[model samples]
Target: MDIHAWQLWILAAIIAGSLEMALPGFVMLWFCVGAVVASLAAAVGLDINVQLALFTLISVTLFAASRTLFKKAFMRNASTVKTGVEAMVGQEAVVTESLVEGYGGTVRINGELWSARPLGGPVAEGERVIVEQVEGLKLWVRRPAASLEVPLKKKEGR
Candidate 1:
């Protein structure tokens, strides 16, 4: 029994499309397109060689076009936002030690000692400050806009 050219093309298209579910992306979409083209060629009474040639050309062109279009759509904007300690902008903390210029100083933030720096004015020990920015492993800090001044203790009557 002889199988028709159109039957072979239709079989190839179904197999290619089914394989795509197991794999990922548009890898098999092009092959399915090629099979359809081959089937069309067979319907027009084209010889087996011409059908094969058309299939090859359509498959390659579709694969290349899909790859280019997918890259532009998915890969161009795939960057993620920084989080955790890297996202501590504008946070407030207290200086656990004095911050001298050009030296690493320690600040207490969220019950942790973090390497810190004075962005402008010197930050004394126990002073409340706000995190201005982050530079490498250190945090640039500044004094808060207002301070919570504690009242002095009163002396007992003589």
Candidate 2:
């Protein structure tokens, strides 16, 4: 019984494809196709060097092509994923304690005390602050905008 080079290539192709199925990332599939192409080259009486070259060329071409094609056609990136406390942005919060320079403060948001830091300068305790952003485990807060506040006026008749 005489075994041929193309026969070995065919077996390698099958193994590569099976490995691809077991661990998927679109990675091994191209190599499997390359092995098949190499087998075809062997069948066509091409030299061993040429067949190996064809395998490498075909595998690389397929892998690179698929990377770009799949990324453009299927891959999606979330523009914004506001998870946990980050979703509380723009919500009003009450300062639990006075915020002083060189000292951190706490705010009550969603019935929870959150460590906060003033934006421009420190704010006093019992003041309303807007959550501007979150850094690490602390909240970056600022005084509530006047537009969002109701102005107090003196009544003409009291």
Q: Evaluated with lDDT, which candidate comes out highest? A: 2
Q: lDDT per residue, candidate 2, 1-158, as tens digits?
A: 99998998999999999999999599999999999999999999999999999999999999999978787777766276777876888988899987765777899998999999888788988999999998888988999766666788989997
Q: Candidate 1: what lDDT?
A: 0.87
Q: What TM-score, over all chains together, does every model reach? A: 0.56, 0.63
Candidate 2 versus truth, CA RMSD in Å, comes to 6.4
lDDT of 2 at 127: 91
| Alpha-carbon shift of residue 150 in model 2 (angstroms) | 12
Superposition TM-score, candidate 2 onto the true structure? 0.63
lDDT of 2 at 153: 97
RMSD, each candidate, Å? 9.0, 6.4
Best by TM-score: 2
